[model samples]
Target: MEETYLLNVEGVKKKILHGGQGELPKLQDGSKFTFHFQTLKDDFERTVIDDSREAGMPMEIIVGKMFKLEIWETLLSSMRIGEVAEFWCDAIHTGMYALVSRGMRRIAEGRDPLEGQKHRCGMGNMFDYHSTGYEDLDELQRTPQPLIFIMELFRVEDPSAYKRDTWAMSKEEKLAAVPVLHSEGNRLVLRREFAQAAAKYQEAVICLRNLQAKEKPWEDGWLKLESLVTPLVLNYCQCQLELGEYYEVLEHTTELLQKHNDNAKAYFKRAKAHAAVWNEREAREDFQRVAHLDPSMAAAVKKELKQLGERMRKKHVEDRKRYQGLFQSSQG
Candidate 1:
């Protein structure tokens, strides 16, 4: 049945294309939905704005959170799994979506959505004429245009699925989570769970990276985030070293050092990686750099140098013995 109006909310219309399976999932508090959505301008052919299917990643949203450009939640609440529906929403419902779409588009283009401006809430910024830097978004904001949303329901998770993990967090939640994940990684390191520790730190890095994507590079805020990410990255490097992922440690530490030459811990971790990979001269240079950056590490660097020398000498002796034995057998 095509509803002329939503159950409670007015000025919205819903048309069910394909009825879903089983009972409709309740989309009240703590319920989550994973679905693909396509937003379009209500033209003769419905011009495309964004398509989750084209992105190849379905959006998972916590119902009733109202944390995004969400006019579809009310329509989704009445939906069943595997259901397909199209909604025609008025400017009242889609206004916020236009603003949010700007940021998402900016992120897609590798540009900062929050660039060239001070902090403003999404609703407050929606009225600003500065625009979302997207032509389609600008047009939507200029006039009260209705939006066509075609959604395909995927899965619904109950409150038990709300573990508050990385993949299931909003931008604000993600920002708050960075520190918690960093600390968890630190604790895991003390337990010598290198793989697990690396996972935590990696999650932390991803959180910061997502948040940083909205800030203009080389700006004060961006630089501040870079400063914060440096230590977390070096911590991950330490874990990678313990896991014998020497190349990863070297790659990450080298990138860190390029941006931050004064990071002594990065140098030390990289030195360890170089030693593991048998890059003798590079390891020596990094050890020396660490000592120069932080003299307190001199003793530790010396100890590592001793260990590396022992390993290299033992390998050379073994190779020489093997070669000599082969030569003698051939002559005989």
Candidate 2:
């Protein structure tokens, strides 16, 4: 007679093996397998994926049962008596198996199966497969596996190396000095060092812009670093604004706003810069966008907007009166 047993992957204790009759399976070095399993419960009613198939075997009968477990049948079948298998499953499923193997780790653990499971299957939920066993219900309650897949796939890289490399440079070391100089420039600005800050911010912007321009579009890190430019440019514009360089503010802020129109603070600041230069029309437009992008700031920006309107009306009337006087003088 053929015998069967279950094998649980390491760090995935909630799952247990049910098919090894004699010896456990051996895992190859650095090899891993990914598979799905079914759990069985008292009210387990198998949903026949195929209606014509008869279900009498434990594997078939328990296939649709509700329970939480991860089993490695292939590893079990391949075992040569002294092999170890290891893999990871998340906490919820792992917890379920832990409860089963450890005999209900908590007495207060809910009997509903879905109570503690963070992942679940339903029409709207992730991993919403139809239930087969009580354990499966627990699996359903847990978050979907696909979401985990995506999270792992798009994991962010650590920036520690970049920070370290940028910080360890002498003034004369052009290769490593730029970021440090930029940092010093920022520090000077914080100390009310407008001139020093502008110099530093300019150096950093030039360095980054040069690097971006030299980078081949298809290079791996090029695109990633290119995304840094917009923020740096915005910072440059802010430095200019702080130094009361309205013309420079106009130049950099215009570019920054063009690239990042969604930033309400940028629009508000640009409005101020325009007003400083007596560019009433442009300032009015920027203030309008600031209010539109952030309704809560509408009240504050409304006053400036009203003032701009009054100024425009007064200018219009003065121009009309000046033209009328010029015509009268010419006729006289």
> Which has the greatest TM-score?
1
Checking candidate 1 for backbone clashes, the offending pairs are: none
lDDT of 1 at 174: 84
Give lDDT tens digits, candidate 1, residues 74-186. 77887889999989888788877877777666666678867764556666667655766777778878776788889999999886765855545677778788888988999
Q: How does model 2 fare in lDDT?
A: 0.50
lDDT of each: 0.83, 0.50
Compared with the true structure, the alpha-carbon lDDT of candidate 1 equals 0.83
Error in Å for residue 146 of model 2: 69
Off by over 4 Å in 2: 1-179, 216-223, 295-300, 303-332
TM-scores of all models? 0.63, 0.37
| Candidate 2 steric clashes | 39
- How many pairs collide in each candidate, listed in order? 0, 39
